[model samples]
Each structure stands twice: as structure tokens, then as C-alpha cells.
Target: MKQNAIRAALAAVFLTAPVAGMAQETDLAKRVEQLAAELEKVKAELAAQRAQAAAAPRTAAPVPSTAPAQAMTNAPVSTAWATPAAALASDTVFSGYGEVNYNRPVRNASGTQTDVRRAVIGIQHRFDDKTKVVAEFEWEHGVVSASDKGESEVEQLYVEREFNGGLRGKAGLFLMPVGLLNQTHEPTAYYGVERNFVETAIIPTTWREAGLGLSGEFGDGFAWDTGLTTGFDLSKWDPASGEGRESPPGSIHQEGQLAKSRDLSLHGALNWRGYPRLLVGGSVFTGKAGHATPGFAANDARLTLLDLHTRFTPGAWDLSALWAYGRISNTEALNATFVGNPTPVPSSFAGWYLQAAYKLWQSGDYVLSPFARFESFNTARSYAAQPAGLGVPATPYERVATIGANLMVGQGVVLKADYQKFRQDKSLDRINLGLGFAY
Candidate 1:
């Protein structure tokens, strides 16, 4: 029994010893795993701290870089705020331009070849957003007459007051507001060598008188212009010579013989500008020449005019057409007295023109336009002539065709070259080359 007990006890001791060793090995493995987990947590925290340090800005860094990325994203907004204020403070609202041209006539039959076609200086001042003034002084043909004895004259001096809704008023010595090419006559504004013949002989462009005018736009792209002005007379009577002439030596005057009579005139126009590429308008005017009525033979005359003007511009092509009719009527007794046996007669006139211009080169600062124009005019439809020497009768129909080019060199300056062929009934063909400008 004692031997059996000893062997059993020894087996029990071996079994307990194996169990304690396995338990110690398992506990050590568990502790090691916990320690490894703690070490991984510390490493991750250190990496995060390093990343933050790398992103932090240095004190010496540029201001732009030091700013937070969120602030930097709003830079465009801040930049835009300052632009308008600076632009408003230094706005360029006042500007001016001028030109001086020297032209030599080619084949001018009138023996009037001359230099210095036109010298003009123009100035524009914007007093505010709505009021402006434009003034131009012109020296034409080096002092008007060929003798070079007179002084240069002021061409245009006008003040423009603009209101809301395209309403405006102009006062002072401005263009007559009669035709298309009259008010705007810069070399670049018109094609061809010069203005059409109808403008020169019949209507007489650059015809301005002292006047006050109002112009405004209505609804639906319609506009109107009306004015009150001094009138003009077709004939001048010299008191010393008793001769009836076309115009006075200095200037044309409507009040003849009767200084007490004041002349009156009216002008109105309607324009449609709905089409972006086209502008069409019609104008009319009525004028009266003040004269004293002599006995049974009335002396006063009445003049009436009607005109149509159209402009079409598409791409690089430009076209214009104009027609005008005019009439002058005198009293029956006056007509009979002037021409011994005249029963009753009324004088009338008509004129028309068509022109086209094309842009040859449009790129860059310079432009070239080649153009052609056809014009015709008649001076007499009703007339009774005095004897041959007393007063010459009005000239008959005149026709003209012109070809020319305008070269624009930079802004506000231009060079014009054109040839005009004029044909009058029972007269020689005359050619004229003219250069003119506004600014």
C-alpha cells in the first residue's frame, strides 16, 4: 500500500508541475501583446504631431503664404472691390482731336488750285454725365478768298444738354441739321473724294446759322428733330449797282432791301433706327425771305424744301441715298415787274444722289474706304429772266459722278483723295479734288 501511494503521489506532482509551466507561458504571452498595443498607440500619436509641425508657418514666410488657406480662397473678391473705385476716380471723360490738311488740286478747270484745304481744331468737354460742349474752329482755304486778305472764321460752337430718355437740346452756331453729311463731315465719315455734288450746289452743306434746336427720341425707335432759325435768300440785290446777284461778297442774307423784316425757318425730321445696320429718315424745312411789297407787285418770296435720307451699313459695306425737292414762289406782280411780260411764275428746284462705300482693310489702327457717288440737280423749274445784263437767269440742270478714297491714320486724323466730274447743260465738264475734315 505504501509503494502504491508513493508512485501515485509522484505522478500527481508531475502533472501539477506541467500545468503551472503552461499557465506561466500563457500569462507572459498575454502581457507581451498588451505592451505591443501600447507601443503602437504612442507611435501613431507621434506621427500625427510631426505632420502638424510640418504644416505650421514660419515667422519669416511671405504674408500670402502665412494666411490661412480659407482666407486665400477669398482673394478674388477683395481684389474686385478696389477696381471700380480707382476706375471712377480717374475716368477719362474729356477728350479732343484736330486735323490739318494740305491738298493740291488736280485738273481743276476753274484755275483755283490752292493749298491748305482745311485746318480745324475741335474740343469736347464733358461737364458731367449729361452736359457737354463741342466747339470747332476752321480755317478754310487759307483765309476764304484767293487774295489771302481775310481772317479765318469760327465754324461751329455749340453746347449740348442731354436729358434722360435721349432728349437733347443744342444752342449756338451749329450745323443747320439739314442733311446727312452736313453735321458729320470727318474724312472717315464720308466715302468718295468729297461730299456729293447735290450737297454742294443745291443744298450747300456746312450751312449753319445761329439757331436753337431740340432733338429727342420717342418710343419704338422713332426720333424727331425741330428747330427755329434765320432764313436764307437765293438772290442778293446790290443797292449801289442795282444788280441781282446769286450771293453777296461777304455772306448770303435773306432780308433784302427791307431791313425791318426778320426771316424765319423751321426744320423737322423723323428717323427710324430699329434695324441695327440701317438708319432711315426724312426731313423738311420751310423758309421765308423777308422783303417789302412794292405797290401792286408783291416782293416777298416763300421757299419750301423736302428731303429724304437713308443709310445702310452691313459688315464692311456702307450705302447712302438722298433726294431733295425745293421750290420758291414770288407774288404775281413782282414776277411781272422783274421780267417785263411774265404772267405768273413760281421757281422750283430738285436734287438727288446715291452713294456707296466699301471697306478694303479693316484690321489694325488704320482703315481704307473706296467709294463712288452719283448726283444731279436742277436750279430752275419756274423763272422769268430779266434782260441779259440786268440779272442772269438761274443755271440749268447739273450732274456729277465722283470716285474717291479715305485713309484713316490713327484716331481723329484722316487723309482724303477724290475726283469729281461735273457736267452742266451747255457748259464744260469740270473736275475738282477736295480734302476736308472736322477734327
Candidate 2:
């Protein structure tokens, strides 16, 4: 009995020792799990704090100004941005411009029109310092389908090359460097809601053609560009129609879309910026536009234009002027070929405009410019010779005076208001408002 009792006691002691060890192990495991969870929480909090610190610098950073450096280099700070060549980064760059306009007639003309005039997006890709490709897509009146009252276009698609001695070359479809407005028609670039009458009527503002061109700078602020380009087509001319009244040469322009290449034209321009804050330029274009029409007897329907323009900005005042003269030969022969036209084509057209604007106020991000403009144009200044009574009257062209103010909220955004007076026989007046942006 004594031996059995001793054995039982020993067994109980061994079992109790194992139970105590299990309890201690479970408590240690629980403590390890809690420590792991605490470590994870601490890690998450540190990551969030690190992220906040990294973003704070960017949010509070200031935009750097290069204006002082530009001034020191004698470079004009007119655009308030880096130079085109310097602004591009290693990546493809994107830019765009847009405008919305409203017009109300104050005279014999009826109705008002509001239009989303244009939306343009452009992209540039640089292969290297010497070569780049640029393209622009345009939407007019917003909608894109042919069934709508809107149109879409590839405004620019060109490859440019930089060579020695400030020389540059471009090939493919591009804006013709004829007038000031043709090359820089972003709404914010000009003063008014509508483009000037002289450029629109005579110079054919926004003109572009498919061609190859060379441009370069010479001695002391002199630059020149010349190109061979596809010319207009006289086959599309319809004399008795309202479309012909749009512009002298623009009405017949095919805009380089699968253009008829039978007749090519030469154009040249020279610009001199010898004086500070002043630029003077002249351009010429001459070509036979008939495109070798089959039915016409005199198919050499030649067109020629000469334009002179200048812009001067002195302190608070800005002055701009342009004069353009255009002529078409062999129009009589071409008019005779028109199947059902009651009107005759003009032989000569001329237009001119002068503008002055003063910076009324500028502070911080706000700028106000009050401007005035005077214009005169004659689309049909003289007609091709015919029986006196057979052709329509070609007399004094229209004259106009415009006054306006442009308020800029930022470098790339503007609000414009203007009043226009037509001073001609059977005149019409109008008020215009517009909003514009570019980047």
C-alpha cells in the first residue's frame, strides 16, 4: 500500500508540472502577437507621416521667375514664358487654345450669333535639338460630324529642322507666313473678338498651304523666309454667290487638302526688328492659280499680293498697322467660263488697318488694355473689263472704326468687349463680347 501511494503522488507531480509549463507558454505567445500588431500600427503611422512631409514641399513651393534673366540677356519678356526652344522638355509637349464669342448687330443686320469659335490642341515631339515634329487639331463650332454646322481640321502638321547660322527649314502643311495674324491667331494673341477686316478680306488671315520652306536670321534683327507652295484653284470660283464675298483670295483657297499641284506659287517675307519694341515686315506672293483648267481659254489666271505690316509697343502704348494689295489677272477669261454666274470677278483688291491700344492698368495677375482701330477694305475695288451695264458696280470699299477693351485675368485668359461701327453706304454696327484662353 505504501509503494502504490508513493507512485501516485509522483505521477500527480509530473502532470502538474506540465500544466504549469503550458500556461506560461500560452502567455508568452499572446505577448508576442500583441507586440507584432503594435509594430504594424507604428509602421503604418510612420509611412503616412513621411508621405505628408514629401507632399508639403510641392504644395507650398513658389513658381520661379526667369524674367530678370531674360531682361539681362536683352530678350523681350513679352510672352511671360520661356522661349519655345527652351520650354520643351524631354517628353512630348502639349498645348492648346480656345475661344467663345457673342455678337449683336445694332443696325440693318438682323439677329445675333453666339459661337464657340475654335478649340485647338497641339502636340510637339522633339527627336533632338535639331529636329522636331508638331501637329495641331482644330474644332470649329464644337460639333465634328459633317451633318452638324461644325467642321474639324488638321491645322498644322509639319517637321522642322534647325541648321547652322540660325537657319531653319520646315516641310509639310503649315501656316503661310504672310501676315501677322496668319502665323499667330490664338484668340488671346489679338485684341478683338473678330479678326480685323483688312486681314480677313485681303490678306486671307489663317492661310495655310502644303509646301517646303526655309527661314533664317541675318545681320542685326533681319530675318527672311521663302517657300514654294501649292496655289489656289480658280475652278472652285462661283462669282454670283455670297461665298465669294468672304475674302478675295480666301474664297478660292483649297487649304492644301489633296491640293491640285498643277500650279505652284512662290512666297517670300522679310522682317526687321532693328529697333527696340518695334517690328516691321513685308511679304509677297505670286502664282498662277488656274491649275491648268481644261475648258478655259486663258488658263494662266495669275494672282499676286504685297503686304506691309508693323507693330510698335512703347511703354504703355501699342501701335499696329497693316496694308495689303492684291490683284488677279485673266479674271475676265475665267469669269466667262462660269456656267451660271451673274456677277464678275474683281481684278484688284486692297485693304488697310491701323490700331492703337494703351495698357490702362496692370497689377499682379490683372491687366486692362483699351484699344481703338480704323479699317478700310475693298474686295471688288475694280472689276475685269466688260460691257458697262453687264457687271456689278465696283466702288469704294467698306470702312470701319472699332473701339474695345481687353481685360486679362491671367497670362493666358482674357475677356474682351468691343463696339464696331461700319461707315459705308448701307452700313451696320455691332457689339461683340468674347472669352479666350491659350496655354
Candidate 3:
């Protein structure tokens, strides 16, 4: 009986062993199949990614870290004045420009001196692809204190919105699209140690106002700009001081400082660049200046400015010309208030300049440009009628000629030397050496 039981048990064990082995084989096969399916899925995903990358649009590779400055140095000079039309940089960008100078009066050595002319810091923050904010803070001279000639001010503060079809609008303080330099007058943007007299004295370089403005660019090489903004305040005019004699608009310019919005100004500009490396444009600004300020004598005063400018860059040559004329109406009554002042309100002022620059030499990121400019301006061209012997005679046009050379060390750093000759006042002639940078 014991032997029979042992045989039965052995048979049962052998039978179950085969079934268990089969189950193990089935489980192993299932795991292999699952792993194979996962491998195929990964392969499909990688192929899709490769195809998408191939179909994507090709973009120019970014410039190497060392090439940005070199590329900017070689860019066309017209790009320097992008202003409101310039595209917003991706993310946040920091920029700045400044200059330090040494001036020696040719006739008086005692007047020789070296000083910091200006330092500026600017920020551009992009909230999205189409909206951005820009601001610039500047310090003039070196120090800003109660007794120093230095000052701190906002050069620009504005928010810009980009619309469909190359149109852009900006509000807050912004530069007027008037002259070649007003919008892009960084130290590295121009050829001289100092700005041209016509732009600086007549049109007021770096002129800006607070208001709304529109700018548009077209595919046909045409651009347009228009704006309504705060204007010069005649109530700020000082007849006793010679400030007005130096720059009529600069003296009375509100600069958005507690500006009087009672009077708004209109400005418009049109530009054409149909030809290669050539640009021509014109601008006009007109407005009432009195703002109905209480006790102001020139309530009816009207200010009008007109300008025509052209620029051409051909190979190694750069040529530019500009003419500007300004007039203030109803100034006769205002001049009567300045009976004893030698400098009275002027009815009209005009200026013109012609400049030429040659790319004399270039190597790597270094360039040398020699330039010459001739300009004529009359700040006090014609004063209003005053009582006998009370009237101030119109000053003769002052002619100036500047010869200079600019040495560019990198993308935005320059060393400049120039000699200025004054036809009206030789005593004002001087030699200037300057170092300037922008980024």
C-alpha cells in the first residue's frame, strides 16, 4: 500500500511541474512583447520630432559673442536713428551712451579744460512681443548739486505699442522726428566731437515732448510720423538773458517738466528711401506757445518750424544736407516788455548745414572717418518792431566750419578730434578732443 501511494504522488508532482513551466514561458513572452511595443513608440516619437525640426523655418544663426560690436560698427549709419520705429528687443535690454571731452580755445589758452559732457543710462523692458517700455536717465557734466553746473534729467520715458502692418504708437515723453540727430544723437552715431550748429542751435538737438505719436513704415521705402505733444512755453521766455539769443526753442522748451498742456503742438514728417543708400525727408512743427497763461503778453504767439534734409551713403562716402527755418508771430508786443534788454524776442531764425564724411580706413573692428561740415545760422535773425532806439538789430548769420576725424575702436566706442573755425567770432574757435561710447 505504501509503494502505491509514493508512485501516485510522484506522477502528480511531475504533471504540475510541466504546467507551471508553461505558465512561466507565457509570462516571459508577454513581457518581451510589451518591451518591443514601447521601443516602437519611442522610435515614432523621435521621428516626429526630427521631422518637425526639419520643417521649421530657418533663422540666421546668432552672431558670435565677439561679433555683435563688429557688426554694429559696420551697419548703415541710418539705422542709428531707429527711434519709435525700432523693433522691441526680446526680453529686457540695457543701453547707455556718454562722452568726455577736452576743449582748448585757440585764442585763449586760459580757457582750456577737460570735462565730462554727459552720461546716460537707459532701460527697455518688453512685456510681450508687441508692447514695451523705454526710459533714459542722464547726468550732464559730472556732479549734480546746488552749486554745480551739472544736472540730472530724464531723456526719454515712454511706452510703445506695436500694431499690425508696421504701425507703432507711443505715449509719454518721446523725441520729435524732426532732424537727423534729434532721435539718435549718441556719441558714436555722429562724426564730430560736438553736434552741428544748425541742429543744435536752431532745431534743438535731443528735442522731445510728452504726448501721443504715430509712426509707420511701408514696404515701398516710405515712412511717416505725426504727433501732438506739449510745446514750448513762451511764458518761460527770458528777454533779459541771452539764453533766447542762443536757442529760442531750447530756452523755452518745457521738456515735460510740469509742462503746460494748455497749448499742444503738431508735428509731422515724411521720408523716402526709394534709392539704394539714399534718404530724403522733411518735417514741420507748428503750435501756439502762449498757452493762455495769466499775465502773458504773447497770447497770440504762434511758432512754426520747417526743415528739409537728405542723406546719401555710397561706398566710402557719406553726404548730408539740411535746412531749417523757424518763425514766431505776434512777438512785437512781447519785445516791448524788454525795453532795456539787449536781446529781445526774435520774429525769425534760420540755419543750414552741409556735411561730408569719408571712410578713410577700416580694419577688423577699427575704422577711421574724416569729416567736414559747413553751417550758417542766425539765432536772432530779426526782432519785432520796437520804439525808436529800443529795437535790437538783427544779428548777422554766423558761419562755422568744422574739420574732424573719428576713430572707432569697437562697436560703440569712438575717439574724435576736431577744429572749429567761427567766421563771426574768431575768439570762439577751438580745438576739441573727445572720447565717446554707446551700446
Locate the minimum summed-lDDT window of 10 residues in model 1.
Answer: 61-70
Q: What is the TM-score of candidate 1?
A: 0.64
lDDT of each residue in 223-311, candidate 3, tens digit only: 88899999988888887788998999889998889998898999998887767777788899999999998888898898898899987
Full-model lDDT, candidate 3:
0.80
Task: List model 1 lDDT by residue over 255-275, tens digit each.
Answer: 122322366678777777666
Evaluated with TM-score, which candidate comes out highest? Answer: 3
What's the ranking of the predictions by TM-score, best on top? 3, 2, 1
Least accurate 10 contiguous residues by lDDT in model 3: 61-70
Model 2 score (lDDT): 0.75
Residue 157 of model 2: what lDDT? 88
Off by over 4 Å in 2: 1-87, 108-110, 338-342, 425-427
Q: lDDT by residue for model 2 over 1-439, one digit each (tens)?
A: 4445445655554455434578876865665566556666767876796787555432111111101111221111223212344343233667788889999988645678899999988887767667877788899997879598898889888888878876788899877777667777777677888989888889887788899988887888788889999888877777678666668788888787889888999999888777787778889988888777787655788889889898887778777888999998987766656535654567999999999888888888788889999999998899777655556668687999999988887667889999999878534689999998877
Higher-TM-score candidate of 1 and 2: 2
